[model samples]
Structures are given as C-alpha cells and as structure tokens.
Target: MKIRYKRMHLRWIFVFGLFWLILGVISITNDSENYFNYGYLIASLFYFGNYFFKSKNQYLTFEDDIITLNNLIPKKLNLVDLKQIKRSGKDYILRTENKELHIKTKFIDKNSLKDLKAILKNLQTN
Candidate 1:
C-alpha cells in the first residue's frame, strides 16, 4: 500500500503572507513620517517565504517495506530495520537496530495517530 503524508495547515502561510503584504503596504504609505519600521514587514515576508517552501517540502511516504520522510531536511528509514515504535509525550519515536528517529506529532490528528499506531503494531508483529 502507498501512504502519503503531508503537513497540515498550509493556509496559515497564506494568511501570514497577506499580513506581511498589508504591513509592507502600510509601511510604504507612511514612509514620510518614518514612525513604522520596515524591518517587521520584511521579517514577516521572509518568514512567510520560508514557511511556504519548507511546508511544501515536508512529507512522509510509505510504500512496500520502505518508509521515506522528506521535510525541509530529508531523512529516510527502512521499516524492515525498525526494532521499536513508541510514543514520547507529543511525539512518536521510532527506534531501529542501529538508529533512532523522533517525529513531532503536535499537528497530527487523532485518527492519523491511531492509524500510525496500528501500522506500527503490524510492523512489530512480523
């Protein structure tokens, strides 16, 4: 089976981008007095840009016996080599015979967590 996972809440990026755009417009309009700082607007735009690209890059794919996690930083782990899977606070920790990986689940839904747990159980059984 193929399982495709993507980060949720992409609209937040658009909303933040709009906020920055508005701030930039306001800053430009009131440039004569120079009371407002353009740095906040620039920083917000940068943050939105960063999030846009970073969120687009974050995903996890599971197919056959392989599990691939690609984020702003990419990592790949083989399911066949995994020795243990457990929950740690708000995260999921996957431990292999030689290495360990921790995935943050603060944004993962309850249903997704249940599905993931079931998958882990199946993996551990065999």
Candidate 2:
C-alpha cells in the first residue's frame, strides 16, 4: 500500500509560489527598485523548483512488512522489528531497537490517515 500526501497540502505550495511570483512580476513591471521583489522572485523559484522535484516522491510505501519512506532521505523499516509506536504531537514515531522513524501525519490525506492508523493499530497489537 502507498499512502499519498494530501492534495491540499501540495496545492498550498503552488498557491503561495504563484502568489509571490505574481507580486514580484507586478512590482518589477512598475519599475520599483525594491530588493524585496527580487527576493520574492527568487523565493518563488525555490518553492516551485522544490515542489516540482520533490512532490512526486512524497509518500509512504508499505510492502511485505517493510515500510519505505520516500522522502529526501529514503528509509525502510521492517514492521516486525518495530519495538514501539508512539504519538508525538501530530507525528507518529515508530521505534526499533536502535532506529526511529517519524511519520508526519499533517501531510497525509484523511482517508490515508485512517488506513495508516489501522495498520499501526495492528502492529501495536501484535
């Protein structure tokens, strides 16, 4: 099973990046010498580039009892080796004897969150 990041969460990145890009373009066209507009333009590019490069890989994949975190630094955890599952604020921390993995719930879609909770519940019980 693969759990995806919420669409709304990804949508916000585009919204904010476009908003800043528009503001920067408008300000530039107005012949203003404000350095802040340049900053905004640069920041928007960073946001857009980040979204384009990383968004597609932002998900959790579970296969054959191994969980793969497909983020900046990909990680895999064997479910059978997980020693503890605990909630820390909005994140779920899964611990093994010498390793820990954090699941950021805020970026997960609602239905996926429910499914993830069910999966974790089963893990906790076993």
Candidate 3:
C-alpha cells in the first residue's frame, strides 16, 4: 500500500559547516589582513544554506503493479516492466525490461527488502 521513507541525515553537514564556520572565525580574528579568511566564511555560509534548503526526503511505494519513488524528486514506474531485482551490498537494484528504468532502494531495512521481494514475487506469478 503506502510506505514512507526517511529524511537525509543532516548531522555531517552540520558538523562540517560548524567546523568551517569556527575555522573562518578564528582566521578572521588572527589575521585581519588576509582576504582568504573572508573567503572561508563565505564558503561556510554557502554550505549551510545548501544543506538546509535543498535536501529532500526519500521513499518507495508499490501499489497496484506500480512502484512510485519519491526521493524529494518524484518518479513513477510500473512493476510489470521490472525485469530483475538484485542486492549489491547496501543497495538494492530494480531493473526494468526496457532497461530504461533502474530503481535503487534507499534507507530500506532488511524486513522491508523481504517485503518488497515478496511483493515482486506475487507480481511475477500473476
């Protein structure tokens, strides 16, 4: 029916942005003559702005032979066209018969993968 996906982790971005911001502040305080200090501050601001505004939520759903993927960016795919499903390390690949579609699973747990496989199997049999 409906499956909800998770949001991207912002902790790393926050940490990196904070580190850069601190570095820039320290540089500005220590060397008032260098323009590079202002450059770092500008760069840090850009990173923070991008991190907060542009990130999207990721999710996958299978319903009535169609699989809908919403990774903030939206995609609609028909499960009937799906040719193969495979697991490669942490990612799951969904290949279509036309080779035009390649769906990758994100933030899916072991139970979710099992559930998806079961759904696919039913689709194949019918």
Candidate 4:
C-alpha cells in the first residue's frame, strides 16, 4: 500500500504567495524601488517553488517484506528487522537492529496514520 504525505499548512503558503504577488504589482505600479518589487516577486516565487517540490516527493509505501520511506530517497527497510516503535511528541521513531528512523507526524494525516499503524501491527505479528 502507498500513502501520500500531507501537504501540511498549504493554505498559509497560498495566501502568502498571493499577498506577495499583489504587493509586488502594487510596488511596480507606484514606481517603487527595484529592490522592493524584486523582493516581493522573489518571495512569491519561493512559495511556488516550495509548492512544486513538496507536493510530489514524499510518501510511505509498504510492499512485500520491505517498507519504503519515499522521502528524499527510496529507503527500503525490512519489516522483519524492526525492533521497536516509539512515538515522541508529534513524531514517530522506528528502531531496528541497526538503525533508527524518525518520521514527522505532520507528514501523514490522521487517516493515513491509522493505515500506517495497521501495517506496522501486521509487521509485528509476522
């Protein structure tokens, strides 16, 4: 199963982007200094760039005996090797015999969290 990462707090980003775009246009229309207009434009573009990258690349997947942390890379982890599951605040910490993985809680929504918990329980049973 594949679960997508939540685009946490995206509405705020869209609002900020619009704010910057409008400010930028107003500054340009009033013949403001080049620095101010450029700054607002850059801020808007930065928000858009963040939207572009974050909306696609993060997800969690369980396939066969391996669970993948599809965040920055295709991290394949064997379910059988997992030793402990720990939760700290709003983050999840998974400990294996060799390594530990920390997953931010914001990455998955409440429903996805339930699915992830079920998958981990199945792994623990097996």
Candidate 5:
C-alpha cells in the first residue's frame, strides 16, 4: 500500500513558495542591488526543501517484507524488525534500535493516519 501527504499541506507549501518568489521579484525590481533579493531567495529555500529540492518524492509504501519511505532518497526498513511507534500531538515517531523515523501527521490526512495505524497493528501481530 502507498500513502501520500495531505493536499492541504501541499496547498500551503505552494502558496508560501509563490509568496517568497514574489518577494524576490519585488526586491530585484525596487532595489538597484540584487543583494536584498538574496534574503527572499534564501527564505524560499524552506519551500524548496519541502516541495522540490531536497526531496524527489515523499510517500510511504509497503511491499513484501520491507517498508519504504520514499523521500529525497528511498529508505527501507524490515517489517519484521519493527520496534516502537510513538505519537506526539500530530506527529508519529517510529524507532528501531539504531534508526528513528519522524512522520508529521499534519502533512497526512486523517484517513491515511487511520490506515497507517491498522497497518502497524498487523505488523505488530505478525
């Protein structure tokens, strides 16, 4: 199974990205130096990191015995070796002996989270 981030979060990310881009453009047009534009450009990096540059993709999937987190680079963990799952407010933290995965619930819809819980339960029983 594969799950995606919430559309609402993506919408906000797009809006923020456009705002920073506009700021960068305005700075370039109003100021003789483009140095002021650098701040806006740098600020836009946050949006880039979330939506584009840092991650080629962001999703979770299960196939056979491995679970994969497909983001930036793909990460796989053994389903049989799963350890702990912790919920903090709206975030989910999955920890194994030497590795920890942080999943932001705000970025995922309620239905996805519910499905994830059911998946975890199955992983636990097996």
Candidate 6:
C-alpha cells in the first residue's frame, strides 16, 4: 500500500513559495541596498525546490514486511522488529528498539490516513 501527502497541502507550499518570491522581488526593487531581501529569495527557492521534489516523492509504502517513508531520505521499518504502536492526538508513533517513527495525520491524504489507521490497528491486534 502507498500513502501520500495531501495534494492541497502541497499546493499551499507552492503558494507560499510564490508569495516569498514576490515579496523578495518587491523588496529588491524598492531598496537595492538591503541584503535581507536575498534571504527571502533564498527561502523562495528552497520552498519551490522542495515543493516540486516532495510533491512527487513524498510517500509511505508498505511491501512485504517493510514500511518505508520516502522523504528526502527513505526510512524503513520492519514490521517484525516493531516494538510498539501508539496513537497520540493526530499522530501515530511506531517504536522499535532504537528508533521511532512519527506519522502525522495532518499532512496525509484523508483516504490514505484512514487506510493507515486500519493497518496500524491491525498491527496492534497482531
């Protein structure tokens, strides 16, 4: 199974990048001497770059006995090695002997979140 971040949330990030880009341009044009404007420009680039990469690449997948969260780096958790599962407000925490994975509900697609909850519940039962 594959779970992805909400499309609406990702689009909001793109919008934020655009906002920062426009702010940077306006500041640069209004006062050429200010170096602070460059920060906004840098921030805009960072957001834009991440928005594009994350839109396509950010997801969680379960295959065989492994759960992988694909972000900037891929994180893998073996189901057999999972020691605990806990639900806290809007997040799910999966703990192993030395590692913990926090799955935040807010950014996940609604249907995917439902599926994830079902899977986690099943895991808890077993």
* Tens digits of per-residue lDDT for model 3, 1-126: 544333343556666778889999999999989988998788789778746643443256666887776544557777777777766765656678664444445545456666766776675677
* Model 1 weakest 10-residue run by lDDT: 1-10
Candidate with top TM-score is 6
Q: What range of 10 consecutive residues in model 5 has the weakest lDDT sum?
A: 50-59
List CA RMSD, all candidates. Answer: 3.8, 2.6, 4.7, 3.3, 3.0, 1.9
The CA lDDT of each predicted structure is 0.67, 0.86, 0.65, 0.73, 0.73, 0.89
Tens digits of per-residue lDDT, candidate 5, 2-39, equal: 66677777777777988997888788888947576778
User: Highest lDDT: which candidate?
Assistant: 6
Ranking by TM-score: 6, 2, 5, 4, 1, 3
List candidate 5 stretches off by more than 4 Å.
45-49, 52-56, 73-75, 86-90
Candidate number that wins on TM-score, 4 or 6: 6
Please, what are the lDDT tens digits per residue for candidate 4 over residues 1-126? 766666555556667888898898889888865666778889999887666655654467777877777644567777778888777997777788887777676868677788887876766676
Q: How far off is residue 37 in model 3, in Å? A: 2.2
TM-score of model number 4: 0.67
Candidate 1 local lDDT, 1-126, one digit each (tens)? 322233455566667777887887777787846745676577687778767765654445567777766565657788888888888886778888887777766545456566666787787788
Alpha-carbon shift of residue 30 in model 1 (angstroms): 2.3
lDDT of 6 by residue, 20-113 (tens): 9999999999997989889999999999998998777766889998998877788889999999998899888899998888888888998998
Clashing pairs in 6: none
**Can you give the lDDT of residue 62 in candidate 3?**
69
TM for candidate 2 is: 0.77
Q: Which stretches of candidate 3 lie over 4 Å from their true place?
A: 1-8, 53-80, 97-126
TM-score, cand. 1 vs. native: 0.67
Model 4 lDDT on a 0 to 1 scale: 0.73
User: Candidate 6, 48: how far from true, in Å?
Assistant: 1.0
